[model samples]
Target: MYQLLKQIVTTGIVTEPAPHADSALRQLEQRLSETILKHLGRALAIRHVDAGSCNGCELEIHATNSPYYNLEALGIKFVASPRHADLLLVTGPVSRNMEQALRRTYDATPEPKLVVAIGDCGCTGGVFGESYASCGRVANVIPVDVAVPGCPPPPTAIMQGILTAISARRS
Candidate 1:
């Protein structure tokens, strides 16, 4: 224990320094926060609906909430219920079983709600397309304000999609 303590004291703080912040991201964060506050007068509430995804987009969404992206700090938050949501972030191709639920969630959200469809699956249905078991894209079930297309778009793209949706609503 004494030897371990001595080694620890000798090594002390060997981790690399944190990376510098991206100016573009800072600008986006500022714009998002200001837009939400200006239009909604408070933080933006989002409801995420996973219509039958492979979970890749979900991973990117999770990354946006991490300390690096810090979505909550930008005045964007995920809510458990659609009733409390100002926007819907839907992912994946709509499965037959989830189509009705997605529609219901959209209906439950208050008026002037924005929907940002994430991934190619949610946008054009990706490799899934329209099938008896799958309903194809999210737009086939509910109105979509913005579609961020990528197999699994990066966190920055997802943030941009949200920003676009909110900004469009302002117009």
Candidate 2:
């Protein structure tokens, strides 16, 4: 135990440096903050729907909520109900079983809502493409304002997609 303490003392504080203020994430957060204020005039509530994902995209989305990303600080947050959401983040390719549900979710969201298709499966249907059970891209069933393409897009890219959807609402 004494040796461990000595080693700890020698090592000192070993922690990752704090992210730079001008980093891409910080920049995106700043833009989101401004857009939320100017466009929505309040916090942006996001509702994430998984049509038929393998959970890869969900994992990446989860990363955005970490301290490094600080999604809540940008006034953008995930919600459980579509009724309370200002934006919808849909993941994975649309499946036959989930197609109706996804449509209902879209319909439930109030007018002036924005939709962002996340991941390659959501954007282009990926390897699944259109099949007997798969409905292809998100736009195939409902309107999509922005599409973030990646098998499981990085959190930063996902953040950018959210920003892009918000910016589109402004124009």
Candidate 3:
């Protein structure tokens, strides 16, 4: 009875997160937006690669463009070819079978391209690091410009990482 009452009251009274906190997030997003516009005026085309993930991180990565977040508003887009990619968003721990593929993918992208390794697995191998078939993290194959650490980092975090990379380039 008491538990039910508490649940009802909490649900009734608790609103969204703090308004100021939401404002802070908005400011961060604006900062990223301004940075992208200032440094990379052109729309950024991203190519995604999965070395050997369970696909958890991939879902969140894909969600960046969907309606809830709508990363396209930030002038971001996904491309099919690595050659045309302005940035590479790589997920999962490197696998023995995928080592060459990973290298080939990275090589296909033109120089001055940024690499974003997402998820704890992509960053540091997570649970799959100890496997004999695993080749450690994404860094084991190519240099990564940004690291978004989480079991599966939120789309906002991934966006920030990409925006940061874009801002680093003067051209």
TM-score for every candidate vs. truth?
Answer: 0.76, 0.77, 0.74
Query: For residue 66, what is the lDDT in candidate 3?
Result: 62
Model 2 ranges with Cα > 4 A deviation? 1-42, 168-171
Query: Please, what are the lDDT tens digits per residue for candidate 1 over residues 1-171?
Result: 999999979977533322232333211222345444467534789999999899999999998887667777667899999999988999999999998899999999997677889999998899989999999998888878778888899887888877666652233
The CA lDDT of each predicted structure is 0.79, 0.79, 0.75
What is the TM-score of candidate 2? 0.77
Off by over 4 Å in 1: 1-37, 168-171
Which order, best to worst by TM-score?
2, 1, 3
lDDT of 3: 0.75
Instruction: Give Cα distance to truth, residue 76, candidate 3, Å.
Output: 0.8
Instruction: Write candidate 3's Cα lDDT for 1-171 as tens digits.
Output: 999999877766422221111221121223234554455536888999999988999899887866666777667788999999878888999888988998999999986577888888988999899477998888888887677788898877777767666653232
TM-score-better candidate, 1 vs 3:
1
Task: List model 2 lDDT by residue over 1-171, tens digit each.
Answer: 999999879976533322222122221222344444466634789999999988999999998887667777777899999999988899999999999999999999997677888999998899899999999998899988778888899887888877666652232
Task: Please say which candidate is ahead in lDDT: 1 or 3.
Answer: 1
